[model samples]
Target chain A: MLNEKEKHRYSRHLLLDKVGLQGQEKLKAAKVLVIGAGGLGCPVLLYLTAAGVGTIGIIDFDLVDETNLQRQILFSINDIGKNKALAAKHHLEQQNPYITIKAFAEKLTSKNALELVQQFDVIVDGTDNFSTRYLVNDACVITEKPLVYGSIYKFEGQVSVFNYNNGPSYRCLFPEPPKAGSVPNCSQIGVIGVLPGLIGTQQANETLKIILEIGTVLSGKLLIYDALSGNSTSINIKRSEEQIDKTKAMKPHFASFNYDAFCGIDLINTIDITELKELLKSENIQVVDVREEWEQPRINELNALIAPLDDLDDFVNQIDRNKKVVMVCQRGARSLQAILHLKKEYGFNNLINLEGGLLNWK
Target chain B: MKINVIYFGMIAEAIGKNVETLQINSIQPNTDDLTTFFIQQYPVLKNKSFKIAVNQQMATNNTVINENDEIALLPPFAGG
Candidate 1:
């Protein structure tokens, strides 16, 4: 039952036949957990609060960066260094006094994913990495929670509903993650400022529809939006039996699943830019640039060998096995793949991938 | 068979074009064959991973492609 203030607050929602008094009550009763307080999360959080979603939980360990100001409208210049989840909650509560906003300023790991996700009726994925996406999907499968998924690139975005009423999960659509380094993130590439705003609102709409039981949800379908072309395409996704079986097999032990290992993100052989800079001044170390010759903004400080990844075989013999070899690429991805190749093919264990690659070298 | 292929996001950047029409001899070409043909045509896409969509439907490698089919190459984006 809406109180006097609540009735006046949601007057617009109360007028709708689809989302009348009963639907408004449902919105006030639903608990949605949103992961990542970045681009998509900002708008999703904003609209959800305005729509009167009762218990909204935000889990993001990231702090507000200067780069986030473009799309993350929840923060201003004053909230620059503050934690994203906390900042978002602080602002959202001010937006709607009738709703409850919970902020968890912690990373969602394999151990805590299920525990945190199980408390919510629905999960909204706003993360920007493959590992967290896979983890969130598997956790939702285990906990049997509906997931509202959205992703953005330069001028395009994808929105889908996964594991809704036992619908096709993310793994059913994308059985396996693309090989590491093959696909670059938004940071590596770049996104238009308004792309996330468009996509995030769609995600928030899906969440509201799910809660109100109105409209056709995006289950078993992918919504592809090209902001540049103003084209929207919907592709039907069929659930994979094999993937469902695999997910079922791990349901009992889902907590123990190592998503990072499953995604093959080798964190052991990575060296940050600062460490790489320090290593360059030391002896018995060779830096190898694995990027193609045509790739731009070459690293000039290091007298590194120009061994393009495709032609690494030709230059493999030139690298001394005795000296520690550090691999470099435009971004850190190619270098990690190079390290894996060198280790597997030539048995070169003395290699390290420069984290964030030459992009972060400065 | 001639198929209309569309590329999106990074896949388009690597292919240097958003859309193309490919002529293949196979009467009923599977996604695997289309992938091989595309990679052979655009060597830059050899290392990239993308999904194939046929006629606005997500398709598996075993899914068949016919003449005048609309196919799209979609790369997963991790951006928020």
Candidate 2:
């Protein structure tokens, strides 16, 4: 079914025994939906487009931020402030005129996830949040679509394939989302710019394999790549019957699933920097710095107690339970952990974690 | 029993090292025991969420670990 132009365009693929003209036609017939237009999404979109996937749908509500230039290779300075999905679509169209790219410049909510994902053969998760990730996984499970998952943090990245051939889903690997704000993202802790590129390329490879039915896919394996040490580890994952049953039970009413609530991201024990500044004016309040001593740019204005996270147990008795306690760290991650420990172990309910920590303090 | 443990991502940051060897007093220790031992030794990990992989396989708390087995602690990463 390949035209003369199509044959020449995919000459390299035609030459390969694994991906000959037949496989190229399969690529042309495939439809993939990629979620998020961030780092991992950038590379996945690029490779998928170049590989001549027939129809690609991109869903992202975020605009192109100045910070994304480092790794989001689809955008340039001119694309800043534009909608990410639209910008990526324009760039990808220029990269390959033979393929079709659909851009949805809106958030993929529980209402739209099922409808949108059902149209695509594969769902690619490039999102950077627990809520969206869980939503995507559930939607894929409900729709019976394979998901190509990728995530990065600091110098490490993780890649996996979920809901493929009745294989393990993301929930099978991570049964529950980590406590909100307990894990710092790239914005909080920095990630090496190249890490996502490597992981995203692997995700693209998995997608191709799934489409071509050639090599073994990462269906029940987690690939952990550490950029710092140049080490790669593969961890085998097992399917959980309980998680599969949970997904099936929610399939009938998938529209009502509240992913944010499921991920426990709606924080009740958090105070913004502005509110903390106002609270500082009052008496009987203590601002505790839980960061390590080596952490920089101390907050002298708060007269904080340097309780450092590892040494928190030693300072627990010294903290005043009657007074309002505010825990802080470099970012909000460790502070949230400290607050959880204090509330759970010490029975201190008078504690709050700084929402954005010192990074947001003016 | 001596076991080799590896930590990844934020778990490595909290543990201060990527890999280590520990001597467990029990001849056959379960993942829950190893988790408890690590939490007691590295209190910073008490509140952090991570999954344990025994010999490159996902491990449940009840999974028994043997001597010379390789265990890894993998923390969740939401960054794309």
Candidate 3:
């Protein structure tokens, strides 16, 4: 029922024949949960709030920083150091008095992602990292909620509506995460502030359309927008049951799943001297020497295979597949490289690097 | 066969060009073939992941590439 004040509030929307009183009611009945209060999140939250969405949940653990001012329009100098979600909620509540805003100032982890996603009809992904992006996608897929996805690079942006009515998930677009450090983030790199604004508004549009059931949904489609080129193109993506089922299978162990390790982000599994000694005594573990033959003071008792870092390709066959492989080098850097290379190129999950190499291996 | 390869995002930055016409040796090269050639030219891309689109259609590694087709290489963006 549109009260007199409510009708005055959304008069523009009501003016549209397509979005008459019925669509206004649908908007008021809709529940949208936006993840992240950063660049894309700011716009998505702004529009959804202004449109009189009945309930909006904003979950962002990030604090409002001075650097975020160029884009994250929801925060200002006074709001700096405040949690983005709470700050966004405060401002958005004032924007539209008719709506309810729920703010969660916590990181979205596997343990909590599913529960939060289930509360909303549409999930908007505005996170700035692969780990959280994948987490949001998996949670949306498992909970069967439509996801309005948007990501921005320096001058380019990508927007898609994923997991809408059995459409393709993000995994169907890129099943495996790119090796960490290979792709730089917005901080490491830089993004045009307006890029996210452009992409985020599109995401907000998608969310409204999904709720209003007007126009075609962006399911199974990936939209690419170039700020510099001034062009928008979309690639047709097919729903991969394999990708969807892999995510579904993880439902049982979702809480235990480590998205950081899956994305090769900050997986630090180095064996110390004591642990190395114990593992060596346990037998059948392969200790790989990534140092060059001439670079090391050899250990007569360790019997470590000398596969230099530069020549690792030649010794790939000799590396044991089923057994544990420990990589060692002069310092710690080369061994870490060996482990990362072996893991990325050869899928050797059994390899562990020895920290500080043999520097203190007396 | 001569085909136009369009690069997007970081890939375009690494390649230093948005579009290029390359003459490939194989008559019917798949997306993998282009990937191999690019990796050989720019080893920086050897580790970075990107997806190929043939004439605006998402393509797999085995998806065949034909002459005079527009192939787009788009990398995943990690920004909001």
Candidate 4:
């Protein structure tokens, strides 16, 4: 049944013992949607396209930035400032003309997640943030589609398959998001250039595996990889009945609500370094670092003090009532918490929570 | 009992390796026993967020670990 051109194009794949002509056919028939055309999406798109996947959908609203060139391999210098999904679609179409590539240059809000996901056989989560991750999981759960998920931060990456044939979902693993701003992004901490590539390729492999039904799917299990030391481990997870109940009740409608605030993405109220520098010259602003004693990125300048939040009562007496105060934490949530408490207790009308906290100070 | 312990993330940082063989006194060490062993060996890891995996699978606090089986300590993961 193989044509000359088709056989030649997938010769390497056909040669594999596990993935012969039958497997190749399955791959060709498969329809997959890869969300977020960023770091993880690039490698996922590349491999899926090269593998001759029949239809691949890419969803991303963000344009490529100069900073993204370091890790997002799909974009080149010329591709910078271009919409990521469009750029990835253009390149992937050229890579394999046999496959149908659909590019959706829009953010993956809850309103569109289910509609977009229903068209695909499997959904690959290349998204970088928690809110989108939860949204994708919920959408996949409701649609009964398998989700091939991958994520990267610094030298670490996590891969998992959620809602695979009634298997556990993302909430089964991490029931709730960490109290916001506690975790740092890859942008803030910096990931190894090849880390997302390695992880995304693994995600692509899982996608193919799910399509061809070749090997074991990572359903109900989480795989953690450390690129720095090259160590990998797998953890088995059982479906949490409570989490399933909670997710079942979730009727996600992004059009009705502000997801950034609902999920705490836009929680940062950051003032840039230039602003902080200017504030110091004025002396009207008091910089309060609310990070605990052991937390790093400490500032060693004037007007900055270590007034941790847990012991706010102890520091209440030390407050400078006459000046405007900028509260900071490792990320930002704690600083906001401090500001809320300070304004309530002392009537500190000049209190402002530093956006993005001290982590963004550099 | 000798068990193969697998460490992940910051737990691997605390234990300083991916896998290690540990000999314990009990036949089936409870969660308390395992936590105590790690606390005794690496005190700094007492507060690091983590979960346990038994025999190449994630397990609960009461899940029984056996000899020659793999046990993993995982930290709070922040990926996608």
Better of 2 and 3 by DockQ: 3
lDDT of 1 by residue, B19-75 (tens): 899899887889989889989988998888788999998985488888899999988
Q: Please write out the lDDT profile of model 2 over residues A1-362, one tens digit for every residue.
A: 78999899999999999999999999999999999999999999999999999999999999998999988989999999999999999999999999999999999998899999999999999998988998899899888899999999988999999999989999898878888789878877777888889999999999999999898999899999889889999999988988878787677556755576566654447888888888998766998999988787787888998999888989976776667888889889999888766653344556788977797666
| Least well predicted 10-residue stretch by lDDT in candidate 3 chain A | A341-350
Pick out the ten consecutive residues of candidate 2 chain B with the lowest summed lDDT.
Answer: B58-67
Q: Where does candidate 2 chain A have its weakest 10-residue lDDT segment?
A: A340-349
DockQ leader = 3
After aligning candidate 2 to the native by TM-score, how far in Å is the CA of A289 from where it should be?
40
Ranking by lDDT: 3, 2, 1, 4
Q: Pick the candidate with the highest TM-score.
A: 3
For model 1, the superposed segments whose C-alpha errors exceed 4 Å read: A267-362
Mind giving the per-residue lDDT tens digits that candidate 3 earns over A35-113? 9999999999999999888999999998999999998898899999999999999999889989889999999998899
Using alpha carbons, what is the TM-score of model 2? Answer: 0.79
Q: Report the lDDT tens digits of candidate 2 across residue range B1-80.
A: 99998999888988789999988898778999888988988999999999899999998547999989999999988898
**Per-candidate interface DockQ score:** 0.65, 0.64, 0.70, 0.40
TM-score of chain B of 3: 0.91
Positional deviation of A82 in candidate 2, in angstroms?
A: 0.2
Q: Could you tell me how far off, in angstroms, the CA of residue A48 lies in candidate 1 after the best superposition?
A: 0.3
Candidate 3 segments exceeding 4 Å error = A272-362
Model 4 chain A worst lDDT run, 10 consecutive residues: A252-261
Give the CA lDDT, 0 to 100, for residue B69 in model 3: 92
